[model samples]
Target: MDPLHPTVDPARFAPTLDAGATFEEYEALKAILLAGSAQFDVRAVGEVHTARPSFPLYTASIGSRDPQAPAVGFFGGIHGLERIGTQLILHYMRALLFRLEWDELLHQQLQKVRLVFMPLVNPGGMWAQKRANPHGVDLMRNAPQRAESGVPFLAGGQTLSPWLPWYCGRPGAPMEVESAALLQVVHDELASRPFSLALDCHSGYGFDDSLWFPYARTRRLMAHLPEMFALKTMLEQSHPHHAYSFEPQSNQYLLHGDLWDHAYDHAPPDHVFLPMTLELGSWLWIRKNPRQLFSRHGIFNPIKAHRIKRVLRRHADLLDFLTRAAFAAPRWLPPADRRMQLQQLATACWRPRRAP
Candidate 1:
C-alpha cells in the first residue's frame, strides 16, 4: 500500500481512488492554509478512516466570530468524483487569502460577515475516485431524512447493497464521519446567526449548471421560500447574463438523506438558514468531449486544462456574489409584507403547476 494510504484491513475493502494524487493536492491545500494562518481560523474538524487510510476533514473561517454575525459557508467534495467542486472552492479560498493582504474592502466586509470553507469534505472518497466514502456509503444520501414516497428506487437511496450507487448505508446506522463533521461545521459556524447561507458544490446531474435550494426529500416548498425567492431575484439582477438554473432539488428528483435539507429543517427557528447545492452540469463537458464518457472522473469534472480554467472562472463571481449577498442579507431578505408577495411569486415559479 502507498504510504499516503496505509491499509488498516486490506481484505475488508478495496481502494478505488487515486489516493496518491488526491492526498498530494490535499497536502498542498493544507500548506496554503498554514501559510495564511494569520488571516483565518483553521482546524481539522474531524477525520474519517478508510480501510487503507485516514483523512482529516478541515474547516476554515475568516471574519467575525460574533454569534450574531451573518455567515455563508462554501462546501465541496461531498461526492469524490466531483473534483472540480473542490478545486473551485480552493481556488476561491486562495483568492480571498491573497486579497486579505491588500483588499481593504474585503477586510471591512469580514467585519460584518463570516466566511467558512470546507473544501474537501470527502477526501477519502476523492482519493478513491468513488462517489461514496471508503465504506461505500454515499455521504449525500447518508443523512437521516427519508422521503415519504416518489423516490426513484435505488437512485433515491437504498440499503440493498453498498456495491450499488446512492447507497444510504445500513438503516439506523450513524451518519458517516464526513457527514457528521460537515453538520458540526454548520452548527458551529452558521446555525447561530440570525441569517445565513450555505452552498454545497457538486456536479454530474444535468446539462445546465443549477443552484438547488432545500427540501430535497420532498417537493413541498420550504418555510423560507420568500427568502429563497428574494436571493434569487437579487442574484438575477446582479448578474443578468448568468446562465445557471435555480430551483428546489425536488424539481430534479426526490431523494432521501439530503444533508442540506437535514440542516435547513433542523436549524434554529430564530435563525433563517438557506442552504443550496451548486450542481455544475457535467453532461456539457461530455457532449463537448465525447471521449470523456469513458472515464469515470471525467463524467463529473472538466478534464482539459482550458475547460477547467473556464469552469473555475465562471463560478468565481457567483461565490463572491454569495459572500456579498450574505453581507447584505439585512437589506434584501424581505420585510414581512414583501415576504408574502415573494412567497406567492416563489410558489408560481418553483412549485409544480397544477392541471388547469
Candidate 2:
C-alpha cells in the first residue's frame, strides 16, 4: 500500500485528491519546511481535534522578518474537498524552495518582500472527505460578516443546519478553528504591514480561471479599487497572453461570511491590504474529461495527469507576478494623487452599478 494515501481509496476520487491524500501533502510540506528551515519561521498556529487524533494547522514565513516590510500570503485548503487549492500552494512552495538554492534575484526579492504560506488549513475536512472542517462549519463562511444585500439561496451561507453545504455555523458562535487560524496569520503577518496581499487558492468555479477581489458581501467597491486596477493593468501589460478574468467577487455573485471581505475590512486603515481568491476553473477540466463528472473529487480537480501538470504549470507565472508585485508595490500601487483617477477608471471597468 502507498502510505502517503492509504487512508482513502484513489478509485473513489479523481487521480490526486484521495481523502488520505492530505497526509502526503502534510508530509511533503514538512520536508520542504525542513529543507528551508534556516530561512523559514514555521509555526503550528492551531489544531483540529477529532475522535482519532488532532491535526495541526501550520503556518510558515520566509523572507523579510521586519514588520514594516510589504508581505504577501498564499493560502489554500480552506475547503477540504478542494484539495487542488492546497496542491497549487504546495507546488508553489516547493518551487520557491528549490529556486532559493541558487536564484540570486529571488534572494534579493525576499529581502524586500515577506512571504507567508498556509498550504493546508483544513486537514480534518480533507481527512473526512468533506468541505467543512471537523465540526461541519465552512471556514470561508465562518467569518463574522453578513451580506447587506440578498444572496443566492443556501449558497449565500446559512445557519439552518450543519448538514447543509455553506453552513456558517451556529449563530452567534465564535469563528471555526480553521477560520480563526487563517485570520490570525493574516493579522500578525500580512495586515500588520504597510502594504500586503493575500491569495486564497480555490476551485470549482466557471469555465475560465479568475482572480476575485473583496466586498463579496455587497456590490460595492473596496478601498483598494485603484490599487487592484493598477495590479490588473500591470498583469495585462506584463503577461499579454494570460487568460485569467480579474474582477470584483460581487460582479459574479455576492455571499455572506466571506473571510477576505472581513479581513480587508479589519485591516489597518493606513495599510493597503488587497485580498484575492484564485478561483481555478475546474469546469474546464470537467468538460475536457467527461468521466470526471462521476467522481466527487473530479468535479473540482483535474483527473488526468497531463491536465493536472498543465494546471500546475500555468499558474506559476501569476504567483511569481504576485511576489514581484508585493516586492515592488511602491512602483505600481497608485499614490494618493492618482487614486481617484485610477479609482474612476477601475469603477468604470469593474463596478458599474453604484452601491446603495
Candidate 3:
C-alpha cells in the first residue's frame, strides 16, 4: 500500500470509546475491520474468562501479495491498564486500511515482509483496567523461561508489591488466560511462519521511548547488530522528541517471563532477530506531576490530550523507519559492514556518563 502521508491528523486515528466499551468494543472493532474490503483475517486464538464477559483474543494480519516478505508482529495491551499500546496498534491498522494505498514499493516490501498484530492480547485485564489478566496474572511476567519463580531476580523484586499500582501475579504459575493463550499462539502458529521481527509495546515508564533487545546478558542473538543499530539510529535521528535506549533482555532489574524472551527462545535460528519491547512514557490513565489531571477526567484534559496526540503522530514516523530498515538492510550491506554500521548507530544513541 502507498504509505500514508505524514500530514495526516492524529484525531482521525484516535479510538472512540463509548460509555460501556469493554472487550465487546474490541470485538466490535475487529468485526468492523473484517467487514471492510481490506485483506485481514481475525483468527480467534483463545478465550479470556473475566468478570465482565469472556472474549476471544486474536492476531490480525495485513499485507500485499508477497509470500516471502519479512514479517513484523506488533503486540500490545499485554497490561490491561496500559491502554495506549492497544490504541496505537488499532490506529496503525486503521491507517493501513483507510489511508494507505499499496504501491510498487509497498507491494514488494509486503511480499518480502509480513505484518501481524495482536491488538488486545489481555482482554480480561483490559476490561477491569488492571495490569493482570482475569485471574490477576501478569501476562508479561508469566513467560515459561523466566516464570517468576524460575527467575530469582523477579522473585523478590520491589515491583512485586500488591499495594503498588500493578500486581505481578502468582509466581511460577501461568494463571492468566491471556498469557497462556499467547504462549500457545507463539508455539503453534508463529513458530511456523517466517517471522522476521516483532515489536511489543507498553507504557507507564520512562518519558522517552526505550527499545529493549533480548538476551541482554549475551549479544549473540543480535546477528544483524549493525542493521539493528542503524535502525535505532535512524529512529532517534528522525524523532528527537523520542529518546532511544537499549538494554539486555535479562536485566536483573526488569527480569520476567517477558514475551520478547519467549520469542527469542522459540523463533527459528535463521530468523536471527530478537523481539524488542518499546516502552513509552507514563500511563495517561494515572494522574501525575506537571499534569495533575485525574485519570477519570483527563481523557479530555487539554495538555495530556495534546501529548497523547503528539505521541500518535510520532508513531507513524517510527513505523516508516522500521519498514525501510527491514527492507534496506539485507539487500544493501555485507555482514561485516552491517556490524560496523550497527556499532556506529549504537554509539550515537548511547548516552555517555560524566563523573560527578
Worst 10 residues of 3 by lDDT: 4-13
Segments in model 2 whose C-alpha atoms lie over 4 Å from true places = 1-22, 352-356
Candidate 2 per-residue C-alpha lDDT over 1-356 given as tens digits, one digit per residue, 9 for 90 to 100: 32111132222222334434346666676666666565667788998986564677888788876789999999999988898888888899889878877899988888778889999999888777788998889988888889988888999899999989999999899998889999999999999899999999999999999999988998878988999999999999999999999998888888889999989999999999999999999999989889999988899888888988998899989888999999999888887899999989998898635443
Off by over 4 Å in 3: 1-28, 35-37, 64-67, 100-105, 147-175, 184-195, 216-227, 236-242, 249-252, 283-303, 332-356
lDDT of 1: 0.86
* Cα TM-score per model: 0.92, 0.92, 0.74
Candidate 1 ranges with C-alpha deviation above 4 Å: 1-24, 353-356
Candidate 3 residue-wise lDDT, 85-140, digit = tens = 77777777777665445556665566555567787888777787777777655677
Q: What's the CA error at residue 134 for candidate 1, in Å?
A: 0.7
Q: Alpha-carbon error at 66 in model 2, in Å?
A: 1.3
Residue-level error in angstroms, candidate 2, position 7: 33
Clash statistics: count for each candidate: 4, 0, 16
For candidate 3, the per-residue lDDT at 262 reads: 66
